[model samples]
Target: METRYDFVIVGSGVSGGYLAGLLVKSGAKCLLLEAGKSLNPKSFPLSPMDLHTQSSWGGGVEFSRQGNLSLYRAKCLGGGSVVSQALVDRVDNEILEDWAEITEVEAFKPSNFSNYYDTVEAVLRPYEIPRDAWNRNAEIYLKGFEREEYYWKPVKRAAHDCQDSAKSSDCIVCLGGCPRDSKYNSLTRSILPAIQAGLEVQSEVEVQTFQEKQDHVEISARDKNGALTHYQTHHLVLAAGSFGTTEILLRSGLKKYLPALGTNVSCHPQFVSFGMFEEIVDAHRMAFSAVTSNDSKLRRLGVKMDSIGIDPVFVSMLLPGARKSLLKNLAHYRNLASISVSLRDESNGNLSLDRSGRLQFDKPTAPKDRHRIQQGLNLSRNFLLAAGAKSLLPKTQIFGLYLAGGCSLGTDLKTSVVSPQFKLHGSQRVSVTDASLFPSAPGTYPSLTIMATTQLAYEHLRKPV
Candidate 1:
């Protein structure tokens, strides 16, 4: 690796990868440092119980009912994109308006985000799942929603050609990595292009701190060997997700300068409900939602529900039973259909470091949030009943896949960490371009929205700096 570069990105996730690709396209020298090891897609895990623990923190998940729910954030080179379902959704106009008002930035306006969405979509080539490829389990949802007269929309995913994989059970391996290379995660779509365009990437190099200088920013990191190395760059981008980015800033003592460094972290809480049917459903055929809800009742509760599929191993854990009951559920896994509920909670959490420098989360799910969750659960139960389900099981609470806030962006430095340009409020050479900059948790899937935000940040950073 070179001793100096124009830009040094701290995380190799969607934001970092996408921004690095754009910078390399503009002929800027970029270096991307990832905290996790590089992945060999060929060996990606195929079973839900297969814990690639080294590539993730607690299997890249956290289960907190009163705080962050079943939160899953991959710590690998490509970050969450490497493990996510790649569900792509644009930010709604109302959400953008809220962001614009909070950040006091015109770029958050609906029109501006539209242009970024177009560009990102063109690059990612997100497509909707075809009707024919719907598994027996997902098909039940389509018919059930239609029968209930609830508004539903097909899910758009970041993939090239998924019909073949969608037809088989291959799509079930989406959590670890795409076995057929059909999904468009940052590893395959963005970072690889950046690498080919001369962007240097250092894997398993965990950034500890950063210092801004007159001419360049100094970055300190530790490799897998525990040896510390320092690097310099004219610009520093933090795309290490909410938890990672916030932890780095706190560890660097920026929390003293930015009081809101690790405050107001939001993880949209979620739950799952299983609808047991008489006939075989075989949910493993497609272990993700092919459609999401647009029901008025759900909107009132700030909730979203979608079809869900799980493997036998995970189902065994979800099933309520001792050994015999667990075995019974496993045998009938194919006869179960599922729906997942995500709530846009008003309650927010805080991120802090324990005495040992380990990150600690305190997000108490407020009573209102719990009420909303219960409302969503009841509605889902009613829907399943109407769908001819013989039995229903409401799963435990977990954090949604999307997480935001922590290092929020706003006009007030007292309440936020970054500015409209994504630059640290009091720093010139440092900026955060990840979910850490979001003012709140989004109600929908956040991968596409994060990419769009990065695209906007790239445009602002590409100019002379």
Candidate 2:
């Protein structure tokens, strides 16, 4: 007989980690399943000096499907949080309003989630961006936002002892797997607490499918050898980001119940703004996404600014193939600097299970979404100019790690994958508690917003204390 759990969570990132923590604390029987391998803090490589191309954080990924693109995400243990910019920007009020308007649902107000935001901030120790934390490149961009009256707030970062990391863009490891263990990925903080609370957390178990049977879900998964593994749960939660979550649903044939499961996906189109300066900036000497342009400016122009660390891989992105030639720039690596402008993209894309149940990008970028990218480009260029950048161009597509949205939610069941209450409409036992549920993508960093709303989701489904 397969052992059963009261709740089985798919994915162990922010939503899963936080939700698991909550459920476990409240005495709920929970089983958290992540598609990726588990990572232990002690065994983690935290320094950029110890990283390589296949590093878990920014290292390459192996897509489960054939003909599907393998994008980079920290697949080990912590998920993308293992190697993502520890940014904690909240959803702008206007954007939140826009989300409700489009979703045609109520209750995603900024104020409503204020306390939730405060709670997460306190736990993560999201620090304020000191003025000194700004690299020359970031400072120049900050000045531009100031002059333009774009609602720029110094971004909050999720970490402790990040001062040194902030000084140099060398915080690359945090994006791939912090070499210094400075970042506070959700697994270390949230999931760990859940485990301490006696929650049974299993790793290396990849969930392939699940079924609804009256009052429970029969989840089928695999062991490391691809052997069949099974889990039973009275309730289910899918926080597997947007991409991973929807893939499981489709493979389980649950996508048939909701026509819009793979539609309305969004990702920020990010590109770097490089500058040739008289001095070595070596911005990569520390943290990433510490300083950011104001949300107002970001929303109007459709792009947000993130302070960056100037490292070699980053150097590779900034001036591709300029490694050996960078001795001249190295003298100015301390002076040379750059910023990443992630556009709040309007274009919605799609992810589908190809015939083999593997994920594939349908390339269904509508004209409006295309237009949003253009707007972001124009705004990014102008922002760079404002920052006194001598050169500016986008530098990515290798990993194609733009924030993609899937399994979107709204009040209209026909148009969205879930309802406004954050419940998977067609599935009685499932709920989507990740970034995939956003109606219109927030016009800036989305970590805080996703978490805040996730808290609301738990509140919605939580059994009374």
Candidate 3:
């Protein structure tokens, strides 16, 4: 006899974990399922290599079908929040307006959406990186921005009591996982509390598929021990990020009913450029990205630039050239500073399962997207040159962490997977509330928005339909 839950939420990432907390607080019996293992602050990987390999899907090294871009997504208990820098930023009003226009959901507009943003911010308690804590890498970026006369601002992060000095190197280790517990990830801020309030959690259980019966939703998954298990829930919530959720849906044969089950994919493709400086920048000693570009022109062009600090392993992979030249470039690792250009792509892609039931995506860099990337690169090169960089190493590859869309929200069933109510188009009890609901790219740091949208989805779920 399986105990049926009020809600069985799959993928305890940002959205699933947070939504489970809300449901349990409302006295709903919820079961949260995560494919990854639960890890505490002390158990988090300390080195970048270990962190990348242990904490993410495919050892943080999955590539696109075209092999032109690298894709990384967290597979840990708290998902990306555990591995990300936790940069908290809201979508721009213009971008929200565009979303509202696309989805025909007025709630997406700034006037209505701000409430959700306000609620999530109150919970996350994000703070801007103060100037006093800026490192030499940040100083160099700031100097470049000033010299280039481009508007810039400090990054806001969902962290508290971080080390004040840039020399601590504590921030570098945070890329793996924050040992100090200062970062407000879902495991600490939401999922743990939900568990305390009687929310059941099943980590290391990979959901294979689900079925929506007349009365209840049935879930089939494989436990960590490779045993098949089944669960029953009154309502099914899929928060398995973009790829995970889409893969599940495609595998379930829902694509036959929903024409857009795995379409309209958008990832903010990022290209990293390195600048060799005369002085030892030691960018990895401080925050990963303490400053972000705020140039209105760049924003209008759907481009963003930011100062970045990455571990030596990632630096070596991102740097151009090979063999002796690569080793020669690596010798100046201590003096290299990096900047990343992220483009809000206009082109959309699709996701499908290959013959072996493996996830496959066709996301090519469109000409428009390529133009934006080139523009960003040109500006970045100028900034580095102005900052006194002797030589530049352009990015050898493009990568993206902000994967979004597939089960997008809209009123039209012909083109969308999820309805405006957050329910799957053809399923009454199945819902999706994650980055999978993004109709298009928000052109900004998406973590804060993903959480805020989950808050909005909770409100919708609590109401009588």
Candidate 4:
């Protein structure tokens, strides 16, 4: 006999972990499933190479079918929260307004989401890094912004007691995992608390498919050792991220009922530009990201620029030269300053499974999105030049860290997978509350907004229809 849980939440990332905590605190029996293994601070990867290979899906280097961009998604117990820098920024009001109009969900507006943001902030306690603690790489970014006369501001991160010092490069290791436990992640902030509240967790279980019955939902998954496992749930929450959630639904043949199951996917394509300076920048030391572009025009154009610290392995991939030239450029790693430009793409793509039941996607950078990237690149080049960079190494390889949409939220079943009420359209026992619910690109760092939106979805779930 299978013990049926009140809620079986898949993917113990930001959405799943937070939702599990809330549901369990409300006295609901919940089971949280994660595709990756649970790792503690001591077990976190020690090097960038190990981090990318172990903590991310496809070894952090899967490219699109069109070969236009590389896709990186976290596949660990805490999902992206474990590997990210913990930068938390809310979506702009303009983006939220567009979402409200597109989904016809008034709760997406700033006024409604403010309280949820407050709730998340109270828990995460995000704070801005002090200017004095800025690293040499950050100093270069500040110089460029000041020389270019572009608006910039300190970035807010969900970190505490980072113990960041002028000589400390501890922050760089955080890209793999924060060993000091200073960074707020799902494992520390949500999943562990939910466990204390009686939430059951199953890590290293790759969910394959689910079927919604009249009364309960049946789930089929495979454990790490290749044994099939079954689970029953009164309510199913698909928080397996955009790609994971869409793949599961497509594999389950649910697309016959929901045409938009894997449509309207948007990834904020990011391009990194490196500037070689005469002085040693050591950008990877101290805080990796300390400031972001606050230019109003750039925001209106759906472009964002931020200082970035890249490990040597990733920097080699981004460097333009090859062979001897690449090695020569890499030798000056300490003198390279980096900045990333991310565009809120207007063009949308879709996800589908191949003949072998493998997940594949076609996400081409649309002409408009290309234009935006180019515009951002032009500005970034100027910033680097104005900051006294001797040479610039701009790579054309595009990648996306922030993945959203696929199972969008709206009022109509013809175009949306999830209803505004957070329930899957045409399914009684299933719901979705993750980045999969994004109707379009939010044009911002979405970590803060993702958590806030999950809070809103939780409110709807707690109420009876």
Candidate 1 local lDDT, residue 435: 90
Writing each residue's lDDT as its tens digit, candidate 3 over 1-465 gives: 268998999988889988998989988888999998898888999888888888889977888898878888999898888888888899899889988988888889999999989999998999998877777888888888899999999999999987746546767778777999888878889999889899999999999999999999989999889999999988999999999999999989999999988899988999887889999998887677899998899888899988888887887766667788889988888898888889988898899999999998898888898888788888888899899999988665898889999999998888899988899987789999999999898888898999989998898776643
Instruction: List residue ranges in candidate 1 displaced over 4 A.
Output: 51-54, 63-68, 164-167, 317-325
Off by over 4 Å in 3: none
Candidate 2, residue 237: the lDDT equals 89
Which of 2 and 3 is the better model by lDDT? 3
Ten contiguous residues minimizing lDDT sum, candidate 4: 163-172
Angstrom error of the Cα, residue 262, model 2: value is: 0.7
**Candidate 4: tens digits of C-alpha lDDT, residues 1-79:** 2599999999988788888888988888999999988987999998888888888999767888898988888889888
Whole-model Cα lDDT of every candidate shown, in order: 0.81, 0.67, 0.88, 0.87
Candidate 2 local Cα displacement, residue 26, angstroms: 0.4
lDDT accuracy of residue 240 in candidate 2: 80
Give one digit per residue, the lDDT tens place, for model 2 in 1-465: 367777888888877877888888878888888766666656666554443343343344333232223344455566666666777767777877776677765566666667778877777787776766665655666665666556565777787776553535555555656656677877777887778887777776778888888878888988768889887888888888877787888888876788888887666655555565555555665445456765653456666666666465455543544546555544555555566656565656677877766677654445665565566556656665676666643443322344546777776767888876677785677778987787766766677777777787888778531
TM-score of each: 0.95, 0.86, 0.98, 0.98
- Stretches of candidate 2 off by over 4 Å are 46-71, 143-152, 165-170, 295-298, 314-335, 364-404
TM-score of 1: 0.95
